[model samples]
Structures are given as C-alpha cells and as structure tokens.
Target: MNSDWQIELRALRYFICVAEEKSFTRAAGRLRIAQPALSRQIKKLEEDLRVQLFIRNSRGAELTEAGEILLRRAYLIFNQVQQTHHDVTIHSRHLGGVVSVGMPPTPGEFIAPRLLERSKERYPDIELRFVEGFSGELERKLANNEIGVAVMHDPAPRDDIRISKLLVEHLCLVGRSGTLAKPEYSLAEAGSYPLVMPSRPNFLRILIDGHAERLDIPLNIVTRSDGIGHTKSLVKYGHGFTILTYGAVISEVQQGVLQAVPICNPEILWTLCVAMRTDQGRKRTLAVIEELIQEVVQELVAEGIWK
Candidate 1:
C-alpha cells in the first residue's frame, strides 16, 4: 500500500464513464482523452482502492462487485460535491431551479395544483415541472434521473431509491350516484359486483387481484380500462363499479356525480410515499421541495380535502 497515493475526483469520473459506457475505448472518446491515459488513470484508481474495479473481456468492461459498490458511492460523492458548490454560490434565502415531480393521475388530481401554488408562493424563482403517469412510469423516471421526486403508491423496494411514507389511503368502492346500497363493502362483497378496473400490472389492480386471490373471491371484472377517466366514466354511466382511493374521485363524489364507499372487513389500503433516487443527495432546492410536499400533504389531510 502506498501511503502517499490519493485518488482524485477526475479519476472517479473517468472510472464512472468507463463503467457506464462499458468500454474503455468509448469512454476515452467521450472524455476526449487518449485510451492509454484513460487506462493509466483507471489502473491508478484500482491500485489506490486496492480492489479489482472491472473485469476486462472481449465484449466490454464489466464492473466487479467492488466496482458496483464504488459506483453507487461515486454517484453520491458527485451529487454531494455539486450540492456543496450550489450551496456556497447561491443566496441563502432564495433557492431557484426547475424541480421535476411525478405522480399518478389519482393523486395528481388533488396534489398537483396545491403543490404548484405552494411552490410558487414560497420559491418564486423555482419552476415546478410535473410528470403525470402510473407508479411504474414514475419509478422509471426517478431511476433515470428524469424526475427529481415522485409521489408513488405502494412502490416496490429498490436499491437506487429512498422512500418515505406520506400517507395511507383506504380503497373505496366507486360507482354512479345512488348505485351502491351499502355504506361499506367487504372484499368478498366488492368482488361480487361487476367491477370496472385497470388491467393487470397496475399497482391498484395488482393489490385488488392479490387480495381477491387470497380470499378466493372471483371478481366479476366486466371491463378493463387503463385510463382513470375512462374507468370512472364507465362506472358513472352504469357500466360497473370500480375500486379506488377517495381522493381519486373527491370532486365527483362531492358534486353528486359519483359515490365512494369504503371497503371494510379487511380494509384495502395503499401507502403513498415520497420517493427520490439515493444518488440525488438532499440539495437545498430538492430538500425544500420535499419538505413542501410533506407540508402540503399534511395540510390536505388535516383540512379533510384528501382522505
């Protein structure tokens, strides 16, 4: 071990580029450096770390286990350095940048407007960009760094992201006005009705299907519609009943266009979470936006606007 050897950020950047591109030749081209120089840097990095970073093969450079771990840490380091630079340069009172957020249609209906308004009121210089999609889509966007933050429902665990619970919402039985006779329905009873639901792989649909299978209830799914509006319209026009969160149809229920009944006897519940990539450190702007999301959700729940 050489006591004087110290790894530089430049070397890490070169390593990351090679790891991502999976070929030293491509990485050197992208970095605008000669291949031998790039190789020398990586060799020095490996020597400094005292671990095999990559396994060279005819195909390309594949990261070793140690390399994978280092890659994750490298991203965190890079983000932290960038955040530090931003912190020292920007004004302490004002934070500004385009922060992208993602959510499914159901939550977006209630949350987006309030979030935008609150962001504008608090951070006038900050621009809020919203991406509306299903939970799967949102997760993909988060992983790809397309969106900085996402509000997801029952998101599966992922290594690259961190999730914080926002709230737990019970599923409701939704239908045309005066269509449902009961105040609440059990899973079995809910399944007995002609159900209009999104197809398989949808987060909500998967949850319902899992419970139905466990309870041995054969759901009478009459139609499958992926669009939340289309599914709600089908129910509104007397097609069939659909299951969703009350927040999904708050306006419709309030206006007498639709009715939402809670599901009991083992309540169907889903958790809403604020998710961000682990590599995206808590920068000032992102941290502020995250706090605002929590505050907005708390206020909405407190005001009885979101259930």
Candidate 2:
C-alpha cells in the first residue's frame, strides 16, 4: 500500500465537513466554497481510498460503514497534520514555540501583563514558562538551559551567562505599613525593627548585609526565608521588615500592605538585567526577552520605584 503525504489538509478537512454535515450544500457553506467544489473533494477522497463514503436517501446523506471508519481515521490524520504544520510554523516563524524565563516572585513591578499580552497577540501559540526565584537561582537555571532568559537583578559572576542591563533603580526600603514614616532612615533605626529577609547570599540579603557591613553593623534578621511572598507575609503579620529592589516593592507599596522608603547612606541601587545563556542562545528567546524588558522597565519607572 502507498500513502501520499503531499495531499493538502484542505482536502481531508473538506471531506470531514461533508461527512459531518451530511449535505453538500451545508458543507460548502461551512467550508466557504461552492457546493460543487465540496462534492468534488469528497468524491476525490472516496476515489483515493477506493471506498464508498456516503449513502443518499430522501432525508439526507448518511455515512456508510466505510465512510464512518474513513471519516474517523481521516479526521485524526488531518488533525495530526494540522498540528505538525502549526508546530513547524511556530518553530520557524517564532510564533508558536516555547520559551522558558526565570522571574522573581514579585513580578508586578515589571509591566509583565502588557508584554505577555502583546506576545500572545503576535504569537498566539507560543508557550512561556516562568520559573520564579531570586537572581542567583535564575542564573543557574539559565546556565543549565532550564530557562532561556533570566529576568532578575544583575547576576554575580558566572561564565556561562551573558547579561544585558535593562533597568537600573534604587533598591528601596520596605516594611510593614506605619513602621516608620521617614524618607530615609539611619541603619540603627532600620535595624531597630525585626526583619524577615532572604537567606544569606540571596540578592536582597546580600545587598542588605553589605550595606550593614559598610556601616560597621549587621542585618538584624529576625527570620530568614527564601521567597518574596513569604517575606511579604511576614511583613503583613508584623513579623519583620524586608527590603525590596525598586521593582519588587512598587506594587506592594501601592497596595498599602507595605510602605516603601528610599534608602540612604551608601545608597544601594539594583540593576535589573536579562541574562541569556551563552550556550543556549536562540533568536526566538532573545526576541521575547527584548519584548518583555521594556515593559518591565516602564512599569518600574512609572511607579517611581526605579527612579
């Protein structure tokens, strides 16, 4: 037996429409084709398979046993072909492929929604997988090819990554609302409260620790956890204060759960970057990263968090 792979999916689709509708006239209407053309495709399909596909009576055409079996198989064949074409087109045109990105949990600071919305409109079939973590973890994933792009603060040294600074802004002071009303507070004052900071080596933790060290002091960490939301929860419960890079703090500040103040005394600023794996580089991945970075920057800027 021989099979032709070159037949247009259009023919199989036309045949299925007629089989389901049971009327050439209705099938043609559904196919946006003349009735005669729809009939011809069905005839051609039956001839190709060397099988009778329909039995016509006064009421309407009904599928013969052969027609039922062929329709089932043809329906599946056409679906598989359509999906294959779709996948190939997306892979080639950057429309329907998958990309993995690492992001921090506090995604709201970046204008992520607008960027994702635009990406979907342009490439409706593209799949974006977001891996949420701090900058260090994200960079590790980028090196492993687990994520195509890492969107976080500028990473520490890693030979496998090539990073581009996308947004630079002062990391801010965040604490439970009403903790302190000062625009800038002394380290002693900032340390007076309990703190729910990330574990040592995490970006925020490192920043806070370095600042305290410079001031001849230390971070007054009440508890250490590994997640932004968990730290936020601690702040919510009045458990402790936490710091946020500008983008991380903006939305929480606006929501009134946390208040943000500018840090002073050897002021710290975080540079948000798009980190790409030198080994896993792909044009599609870069295109998506480029599209998202601007929106993230815009959001941070508009909220005055990244100023």
In terms of lDDT, the poorest run of 10 residues in model 1 is: 75-84
- Segments in model 1 whose C-alpha atoms lie over 4 Å from true places: 1-93
Cα shift from native, residue 197, model 2 (Å): 1.2
TM per candidate comes to: 0.71, 0.64
Kindly list the per-residue Cα lDDT of model 2 for residues 1-307, writing each as its tens digit: 1276356677877877787678777888987999877778777777777778888777677999988776767745653553456545555644555566678766533545655776677667766655677778777656655566778775776678877777676766678888867888666567666777777788767877777877887667789878787887888778878777655666667788788777766677777777776754445545665666666677657876556
lDDT of 2 at 72: 62
Q: How does candidate 2 score on lDDT?
A: 0.70
Local accuracy of candidate 1 as per-residue lDDT tens digits, 1-307? 4588665899999998899789999999999999999999999899887889999999999999999888877766665665676768666776887687898998888788998999999899888978889998899868866678999999999999999999999999998999889989998898889999998789899998998888888999989999999998999999999999999999899999999999997798999999888866656788788888988899999999998
Question: All candidates' lDDT scores?
Answer: 0.88, 0.70
Off by over 4 Å in 2: 1-94, 108-111, 299-307
Error of 2 at 177 (Å): 2.1
